[model samples]
Structures are given as structure tokens and as C-alpha cells.
Target chain A: MKPAIDVVRLARHPKRPTSRDFIEYLVRDFVELHGDRRFADDPAIIGGIGFFDSIPVTILGHQKGRNVKENIRRHFGMAHPEGYRKALRLMKQAERFGRPVITLIDTPGAYPGIGAEERGQAEAIATNLYEMSGLRVPIVALVTGEGGSGGALGIGVADRVYMLANAIYSVISPEGCASILWKDAGKAPAAAEALRLRAVDLKELGVIDGIVAEPGEGAHEHPGETMSHVRKAIAAALQELLVLDAETLVQRRYDKFRRLGAFTLDDGFSELI
Target chain B: MLTRLFVQCPQCQTTHFISFFKSADYVCSRCGHHSRLDPPRWIKQLCNRGTFRSLFANLKSLDPLGFPQYREKLDVAERTASGWEAVVTGTAEIGDMPVALAVMDPGFIMASMGSVVGEKIARLLEYAADRGLPVVMVICSGGARMQEGILSLMQMAKTAAAVRRLHGKRQPLITVLTDPTTGGVTASFAMLGDVSIAETGALIGFAGPRVIQQTIGQKLPPGFQTAEFLLEKGMLDIVVPRKNLRATLVTILKIHRTRPYPVRRRGDE
Candidate 1:
């Protein structure tokens, strides 16, 4: 029933565990922050100060609620511009206090509502990308669940990006892809297979740093074990990154991303020369 | 046999000659409906004669995800559009001031950014960094290509990182948003410009208006995601008519070339 062997089913479990599970099980004491300071607070993303193994860390991630009421409250984990702005503000705060920033990736995407756009959602995400790239602190991003597009990448670019074994990351969800390409949302199962959004595929393609293992059926069935695995993986990465100074850390991170996709030109096209 | 073909404008419902419509930059004479431009024609309109140097044209995409019919779609895209990816980036001169330019055309599979487009942008900006040239990117995209999956999504981060590196090096980035710049493209580098510009009637947003309407289950306001709407909302510096796009870039590049950007941060060296 758990479908652990089927990556799509494992990843797409409607009741798959959410980020609250991670913060609760992993962080010793977590205090959540609210608002982007410039706008109203967004419940879709949860951000604040937390201690990871006695080390102060800024924790941020998309928050999908457990029930229908919670989902409506959290906007089904679709972050708005304020959510990103809040995350950026927290990341900046973390930098000032020399705290490592931890982001848990899980979002279908940024909220696509009309108001979100008018309020500068693009500017917010772009600012995060520009600022986070140069932010002088250790940043770690883990794809704890559905890491979807710019909404996920809003906080996803980090010193290291990891994915839980059962997590899925994609530009567009299978349903959306199916609707757009084949004009049929019923073909989502086929679309999911074609997406190759499982952790294993992304890891092989050099899209993520590593894959954190899960204990049983996946995060939904074994949230505790999942949290522990993620905590250990993030701690190990932080230990490795904390050694270097700001300049070196930023440079190394940039270099790491810069080397992700390298395409070469074969000699056959030399006729133009 | 076929001497003439008339196409009706979607906005105005007016018929126009095919040759006349194309020569007019695909604009409707009656209603001023600005149609999308293809990449090669876009380059011709923006750059000096014989000055465009397309880099990384060989960085074509593969069917990494083994998505059904993706390879065949790529073949079709390559044949219909140019042999390049969604973005064509290179060093070119806007008049005398040499600028690094990236022009995305909706013709090339909706100018969607994938791994190749991302790599091209990152490398192009890096190239600009070495030369200390200004950047003006004409954006017309349907966002990230869904066929490439997460790899396409990663391009959002990768391209943003490139823009960051360019910014760290203190280069001027002027983003020109054209029709249909939405989704991942809008959420990343499309709005990161130091001075952002949108062409008149351009549709720019994180999501398509239809998607929003469906999500919220409501009727959208008229002219919701248009350039005029975005400008009123303070998202754009200004909206220029397509006719003035080249001149506007020239003016901006000239001023930037003359004055240069002041260093704004510590550790920028």
C-alpha cells in the first residue's frame, strides 16, 4: 500500500509528510518568524530561528498543512512574494548573526495568484537569487518533499542542496505537464515517468548534492526516521562548509553550481568555420 | 496558385496581408496588437548589421528524462526555429557600444529556459564580466520547458546565479520583458535588472492569467498581466513601444557606458 518501490507513487502520496514534521523532530527548540516586514505575513512558508544540535541556525521552508483547513491556511504550500521576501530577510538576518541558514524545499511553486504578481513576486525571487548567491554564510537546502520550480528554488540555491529519498523535484507537476503537453491531466502517471523527478534521477544528473535515505515507506510513514536522516545529512554538510571563510564559501558554492551543466561542441559542425 | 493569404488579428478581428503583417513587426494596424517576433528577426531589430556573434549555439538539449516524444519535439523545434536553444546569447554591438545581449524568442518552443538556455546565459554573463560590458536581455518566454523536468527547473537557479555573478562584478543588467514572460522566467532573472523595461502590451507575470483565474475560481480584471498593468503596479521602470526598443537600448547603453555604475557594496572587488 505504501508503494515504496514505485518512485512516482512514493513521491506523490497525497498524505506525504510536510516540513513541520522535520522542524519538530529535528530542531531542539524552534521559534518561527513571520512576515516580510514590508507586507503581510504568508503562512505558506515557515521561517525562524532554531538550534540544530546546539548550533543556532535559521530554518526556512515551504509549509503544506496536514488537513484541508490547514492546506487552505497555508495556501497548499504555494508561497507568495512575501513568503520569499520573509525568507530572504531571515537569510540576511542569519548572515548578520553568523548563523547557518537551513531551508527545507517543499512547494508546488510560488503562489500564482494575480495579487502575488502585482506585489512583485518575480522581483522578490530574483532578489533572493542575487542576494543569496553572495550572502556570506553557510546555506543548506533540502528537498524534503515536492521541490517545484521557482517557488522551491527561491530558497533552494544553497551551499548544498539535498533531497530525501522519496522526494520529487520538477519544473511542473505531472498533472500540469500532462495538461499542457498532452492536453489531458489523466495522463499524469505517464507524465510522472517521463519527468524523472525522483531523487535518484536528479542525483545522477548532478542536480542535487546528495540523497538522504528514508527508513520505511517514506517520509509520510516514517517521519521520525526521515527527520533524523535529514538532520544528520545537513549537519555533516554544515560541518564541511563551516571550515572556510565567507569568500571561499561563496566562491565554492558558485563554482559548484557553475559546473552543474557543461555542454560541448563536437567537431562535425565545423563546416561553418 | 496561391497569390494571397489573409490572417485575422485575434484582438481586432481585422484581416491583413501576410507580407505586410510580418514587415510591420507583426503589429495590427487597426488595433495596435503587437504580435510575437521570432528570434532571428528580433536579433535583426536589436543588433547592428552583421554584429551578432552567437556563442554556444552547439549546446543543444537531449532527452535526458526520456520523456515520450520529447526528442521528436526537439527535432521539430530545431527545424522550425533556429538550430539554437530557446535563448540566443552573445556579444554584439548596439550601435558603437559593445554589449552582451541575450534575446529570447517565443518561436523557439515558447522561448522556454532549459539547461542549455541556463548554461548559455551563465556563460554569457561571465563573458560580459570579463569584458565589463552592459547586458540587455529581451525576454519573451512561456517559462521553463516542462519536458526537461527538474533539470529545466534548475535552470531558474543556474541563470539567477549567473545574473548574481554579473551583479557582483557590478555590471548593468537591463531586462526587456516582451509578450508572455511568465512562470519561472518571470520569477528569476527576468525581473532582476538594474533598470527593468517592458515592451508595450507585453504580458509579464509569475503565472498566466488563465492559471490564476482557474486557481482562484474568479473572473480576472481586464488587462491584468499586461505591460501597462505592471507599469502601474511599479514593476517596470517604463514601457517602450517596440519601435523604440533599439534606440532606447542604445540610449541606456550609451549613458551607462559614459557614466558607469558606482560600486555599491563592500567585498565587491
Candidate 2:
């Protein structure tokens, strides 16, 4: 197994294939959608209607810029309230049209900014989780790079969730965790290990459905092959998800998230206390 | 002896007799700053006398990730909060109206949503759904528990799905956003209420104020992320003060109550 920090480094590689790259390669005739309608358009998250392998689908993801200038514009792929609301709007549209929704997760969490909070960031993400729970459509989410906290889960409450081989998903970033726990940001490697954020770890923990294999080294090395794998994984998931009735699809989606937790019932402990 | 008898309000530094403060439900009489309350006090204040019966009290958190110091922290939380978990859930009656209530105690690891907290809330929602009872939750939290890692994050989805099920049954979910509701808790069930009411001076948002400040590299405007701020942004229905909370809740519950309808048998048209 790779050291968790190294996976984090690979996940954040400058040359890695971004959400835009995947959409451009796998989604044909993709028409980009913009704006939350309630607020200004957030460039951090790009969502639209597109065709995946001739199947009409709604594709959306957190888009990290390829260069410094664009990165600043995208807020380093950290979404604001508008980004989540836009995703929710597009998701509702997908449901109305019976189109399968494919979300790519890559963010450092929602943008922690004054404007974001003033516009109701929590409500935006909360609405997505509540609405997506009952969305009567096949929904698939792939953690293409970094899956950060509620921002990732905002678009991640899917029927099937997948992760790239080198990707990392965590409650908090390693640096954040380290600073809080160890009181030192430099202890990120140890924090990363403790968080168990790698794709394999998440698979074992049943937090994700499957892992898409990256070709050689990582996705940044072989973007074409890597995207092909992501395409295949998504297609496979949709193949299995499409046959179910709307009721079952929604119920199963709810159950999938409903079953995620690790705890023990200590009746004796309660009594002792 | 003076410190024990007189408690100083953290917000205003007004010292008052502990007895008087307790009688006031921990709200500072002089400055009206609402201090955080434990589950026991919350139930006593919100629920009708002797009407609260605790539920899901046996679910305890496990160090699933075996993160450093987590077990110690849980032990400390259990001791400090005097509870099994961050939330205390149960069936209760408010002004004679039966309901399900869940109160998150911020004293317990800042009431962070771990597996136990999530599972308890989810089960409470499910239990309420089964009995066709409305749920009233008092929410206060820092966010997802970091020690639990991805499992803690998953709790947000779990609780939200449970809330969805309760909504599907046409059962009402009224959430009382108290002091310091942020992060995963804010982004999940806390904000999913059919009627969201925040207490005055409560901090409610996805990201904490300090985080927003650090990200934007500027001082936040006065009263940012407060319950009043949320109300102005159209995110909350109303903001009530601590003293009026119980009465307000009772009024809301009464208004939501439907008239009794006759049940139809299988053969009856």
C-alpha cells in the first residue's frame, strides 16, 4: 500500500486530469450550464447536460484550474453556496428529465468565506442532501481527485460512489486534522495515516462503492487511460442502477447512505455510567 | 466559594448567583447571553415535567480509525457531558403534545457528529417516523468528529437520509439552532427542518467565523453568522430568545397539530 501522504501528493498533482478534462473526454456534445439563478455563477463548480456513451446524463464536478490564473478564478476548486445551489438546480433538472446524474468530486471543501456564509452555504449543501436522497434517478459520483467533507458529500449522496485509485476523501484535510490534533501542521503525514483517506481504505470502510484504477504512476501520467477507466466504472454503475424502479432506486440510495457508520451498542457501559 | 456561588456570564462578564442563573435556564439576566446547556437541563426546560423518556442511550462511539487520543477524548467527553454521546434523544411531551426530541450537548467534544451521534439521530428520526410523531431537535455542534474520519463525514448523509424518510411520512421536523451550529451538523439534519428556528445570539453557518476570516484574510462584519444574520439572509424562519423558546415551541406544535380524522376500514368506502 502506498503511504497515505504520497497518495495525497499524487491526488493534488498539478498535471492531474481535472473534472473538465473528464467531461471533455467522456461527455459528448456537453453544453455547460452556469449560475445558481438565486445568485451569481460560481466558477468553482461546472455542471451541465451532456451525453455519456450516448446516454443522456447530467454531468457536474468541482473544477480545479489548470493554471495559476484560472486556479484563482476557481478559488482553488473550493465551492461557495452558489456552487452547491447550482449543482442542486442541475440535479433537479436531471431528475425531471429522467437523466442519470454523474458528479465528479474534487474540492478542498466549500469555500470558507464571508460571502459564502452570508448567502447560506450550510442550507445550500443541506438542501442537496435532502433533495438528492429522494431524487428518482440513477445517480453516480466519482471522487476524481480530492473529496473534501460536506462539499464533496453535497454532490456525493449517490446510488453508487466511486473513487480514483490515487484519490483521497476525508472529513478534514490532513493539515487541518494535524493542526487540530497534534497542534502542528507539519504532522500532516501522520494525520493522513490516521485519517485513512486513500481509495483502498475508503473501499474497505464501505464509504465508496469501487475504485477506478489509474494507469501507471497516477492519473496525471496517463490521463487518457485514466479517464477511460472512470468512464467504464460509471457506465458499469449506471448499467446496474438503470434497471431499478424509481421507488427502489430512491430507497436503495437512501439505504446505501443510511448504513454508513461504525459504532457499538454498549448497554452495559450505559448502565455503568 | 465565590466562584462556585456566582457565575460570570462569558459574553458580558456579569456575575450572578448560580441559583438565579439556573432558574433562568442559564440565560444571563443582566446581559441576556445564553449559556450552553446540557441535555438534562434542555429536556427539563423544553419537555413537560416527567414526560421525557430517553431513547438509544446505549450506542457508544468506537475508535474505528484508532486515531490518536480519540479514546481519551471520548472518555473525557463522556465524563464532562455526563452522557453516553453528544446527543440525548427520546420521546417527550411539550405542553401535552407528544413529540420526539433530540438535544445535542456542546460540552461533549463540542457535540461533534461521530458514528454514535449520527446513528442515534438517525434512529430517533426513524423511531418518530414509525410512531407518526413530530421531531424537535436542539442542535449545537462544531462539525463532523475528525477522529472518526470518513465515517463521521458519512454520518451527515445518514442523518439527512433519515430526515428525508421522516419527511416522506409527512411528519414535521422542527430544529432549534442554538449557540455554535456549524460544519457537518449545519450542512445536514440541522438545516433540513420544516421550520428552522434559531435562538438569539446563536452562531449558525456552514463554516465557522474564524475559518471564514482566515480564508478571506479580513475581519468579519459585526453579527456575521448569528441567528439574526441567518434570518436576514432568508435561511431561517424566525429567531427567538432563550426565555421564550419553550412557549414558542409549544405554540408552533399546537399550530401544526391536525384535527382528529376518522379511520376507514378495508371494506368501508
TM-score of every prediction relative to native = 0.93, 0.96
- Clash pairs, candidate 2, are none
True contacts kept of each: 0.69, 0.90
Q: Mind giving the per-residue lDDT tens digits that candidate 2 earns over A84-198?
A: 9999999999988999999999998999998888888888898899888889899999999999899999999999999999999999999999999888999999999999999
Superposed Cα deviation of residue A96, candidate 2 (Å):
0.9
Please provide, for model 1 over A1-273, each residue's C-alpha lDDT reduced to its tens digit, 9 standing for 90 to 100: 222227656665667877777888768789988999998899999988988998999998999988889999999899988999999999999998999999998887889887897898888888888788888999999988888778888898799999989888888877888898799998887777778788887888788889999887677888777777888899899999888899999988788676665344544432100
lDDT of 2 at B94: 99
TM-score of chain B of each: 0.93, 0.94
Query: How accurate locally is residue A186 in candidate 2, as Cα lDDT from 0 to 100?
Result: 100
- What's the count of clashing pairs in each model shown? 0, 0
